[model samples]
Target: MSDVGRDIRLVGRDLPVGAAAESYRALVSELKAAADVLGAVITSHKVAVVRAADDLIDSLDPVAVECGEVNALRREGTFLRGFARDPMSVGRVVDEIWPRGEHVVCLGAGGSAIALGRHLLSRPEPPSLVFADRSAAAAAHLESVLASRTGVRSDGSGSVEAASAVVHVGPGPWDELVAGSPPGTLVVNATGLGKDRPGSPLSAEADFPRDAVLWELNYRGDLALLRQAERQGVERHDGWQLFCHGWAAALGPILDLPDEAATARRFAELAAPLRPRTGGQ
Candidate 1:
């Protein structure tokens, strides 16, 4: 808001991970009914909210439809608009760090993983993507989502030629995936463990790939994974840039901002002081 010179207040809402569809519907209805609520940024409930309140949203951007998630909401008169801004935001952060055709290991196969995979696979030279999740369902869902969007299928085995694959890390360690990745791989923690939950995706014993770029998608928290990266002398990036770019992307339509990049830069400058001085920095 400071970047745009608008007086806007952000309120945080906490919802359980597997909340019922009706609960999300009620929340969406409340936002629509509230006159003062200009817009909202959905966090962990991106997919759940969209699935539960698809009828309540008047418009969904193409990305939202494709990704089956909604991360931003805007109310226009009687209509509430939904958008999936993760792709745009995650793309901004990834592009700054990723070179084409490198390997990428995303720890959590959730909404953010879908967005990141979608963006990366769409590139002319798609990188080898390996998505890992504790839940087999989540990993399968990510594979289906990516296949639907990119028309590229993963052949169960994570062959380089497949370009995309999912691994179920149930009752096992994430260390193997990280250790097996080729040098210069981009390892990402898309899991909400550090912030919304506790602990790191990779255990302390995990060995990071040589010349790996570690990306922890949480700017504030215990950030155990980030600390581990720093300890190993890996190049690291936190989610601060993604957070700024995501808000700028969402606010573009809500507040009708003229330049999203400028707004994001301004937001970063303003929020820099408040950012946690963690290992990634």
Candidate 2:
């Protein structure tokens, strides 16, 4: 907001994942009732919030509908609107680093993973996806969503060429999966472990794929996964770019700002100084 010269006050609301529908409904009702409140940018509870308060929202953008999540909320003259800007935000960061035809292994089957899958499948030549989550339900949900969008199937075959697959992993220690990825694959830690929770998706013993790009989707926190990537001498990306792009995409609708690359770049430049410093910064 400071980048756009808007004097908006940002507030933080930390809601646990899978909170009851009433909790989200109350929050949405409060926001709608508050005339001074502009809107909000959701983080971990994107999908949960949307599921809980679907009927309360006056409108939802196409992406929100498709992804079953809402990362941005806006109020428009007595109407409450929801938008899932993660695809746009994730696309910007992925396009810069992702090599065409390289496999993608996302460690979480949450909102960000779904967004990444959706963006990748939209490409003319979609890269094969491997989504792993501790929760069978979450992995199945991601598979179902992707299957509806593209005719991809998950048959436990683990065939990157024929179909994408969702693997239900145990808690921690994904050494075999991480080490077995093809060279130059894009390995992502979409699980909120490093940020929202403590710890990393991969154990310290895990070895990253050769020439792979490791993307840890957390700008701040312990960020053990990022440190592991660095220790292994692989090219790594943090979530700072995604964070900036997400805010820019959300604020574009809330503040009526221009949606263009230049604007997003300027926003990133302005936000750079405020980014949290991790180890060896």
Candidate 3:
């Protein structure tokens, strides 16, 4: 393939109120004008916009691949931290609920949630995946794309088959879905309300069945759900683990590198410049 036409691109789509679509819409021209745009992945912090851009890019069928097949690699704040955790524990959860217990629910629509949903789609039996976001239209669009390759639904309920499933839960700064899960259920919290921000999906004091595992995708203290889970005597997973787990998956394709392990090595080398600059993490 010729390198001349190989470039990563982002398209702007209309957004819901409070989202920064206008700003991103303006950047499209500037991004397209820049040199060395090829091989670079376009990213957006907003989940809906990312999905829109992803749809646009897929329509163009660019040669460049997405990072972990995700349009953006967000930091471990609220949404990303949530996505990072699913892959970390999903395998173990799948093993526990194997053959029949292969349903996974993501509580939001963001880079992290998309990454986890994609990861689960690659597994054996391909756990039924669902995308429960406040934006019903965005959830439908993303769910459609996810189900295109895997036999899944995002509606959360219906057709319990060996496919991914999605559910659109409107206006949730709530956790009714996660709290209602049965034992050994794999529930991932992919929202940003309880990160450095206050207000968790469900009450920190809510009683989660012993068989269910609650993991929050935040890395810092004073605002992390991990701490809240601890205080509530709930078993929780950490955000950094999600970061590490998803990193291998996301970086590989974005970097045009080999397998997850090789991509990790290359990224470690690239990050060497930051070790002394940031004093290493």
Candidate 4:
């Protein structure tokens, strides 16, 4: 299993959803022996488990079903494949901005950082992208990996690869990063700081460029980032829509749904009533 920082595999008491404290290796063996391993459902924090599964597979391969910081995993035939579902939401959310900015910066080089950066970096005529984290190593690892994906080959240390000339990766203290952003910039809070715990990634002294779009990935929480964005009077969005798209996209491959406009629209319509309100008010 892979994680950005700490590895808190499971949280709280097992409750009724109990499972053994088996090693990832043992779990993979069990999964392989099961009657027709359909697919695996994964949450972000459990990503390392999937990576372990990928390593254990021999007969078939592990494919990445959903792409983002964390991916949904499944087995095919003797192949390990990785799929990113987050891009479906990422693209949609960015499109709503009508005209996109010349730059896109993602704060926090966690799982979502890799997934989001990949999507943004791969687009034709992509905007200049920056991913900054408190840990230089973490930020570099992300940058190196992302850059290498451009057929550039990264050293896994997040060094800036020359092949991917458009991106700028760096360390955190994002206030300066935010302050220098161009107007209409697209800024994302992928840190999971405010959502899971509390506090904003940016300091109160940070400046948001005019007409920028602020996207808070956690729909519900004590969101300090969203409040700051709102205070700055920028166009703001919560992750509710993105969350819907993520599930739909992840399930698409599993349920064999068509990747059509109608399908996406239908998914959104169905999910709308179920999505809780996430305004900072």
Cα TM-score per model:
0.91, 0.90, 0.60, 0.72
Number of backbone-clashing residue pairs for each candidate, in the order shown: 0, 0, 19, 22
Which candidate tops lDDT?
Answer: 1
Local distance difference test, per candidate?
Answer: 0.84, 0.81, 0.47, 0.60
Q: Model 3 over residues 1-281: C-alpha lDDT tens digits?
A: 21213343444444343555555444433344444433223322544433334433322212113312333333221112102223333343333333245555566776566556665676644766656787765566556546655653444455455564656767764455656666656566666655535665655555555565555555443444445556656655545444433455444344443455444455455654543221111
Top candidate by TM-score: 1
Who is ahead in TM-score, 1 or 3?
A: 1
* Candidate 2 segments whose C-alpha is farther than 4 A from its true place: 152-165, 279-281
Clashing pairs in 1: none
lDDT of 2 at 45: 83
Which 10-residue window in model 1 sums to the lowest lDDT? 159-168
In angstroms, give how far residue 187 of model 2 lies from its true place: 0.3
Per-residue C-alpha lDDT of model 1 across residues 210-279, encoded as one tens digit per residue: 9999989998889899998999999999888888898888788788889988889988888888978877
lDDT of 4: 0.60
Q: What is the lDDT of residue 43 in candidate 1?
A: 69
lDDT score for residue 281 of model 2:
21
The CA lDDT at 279 in model 3 is 10
How many clashing pairs does model 4 include?
22
The residue pairs found clashing in candidate 2 are none
lDDT of 4 by residue, 5-81 (tens): 22323222221112332555565565456555544434454344544554564432221323222344454643433
**Per-residue lDDT of 19 in model 4:** 38
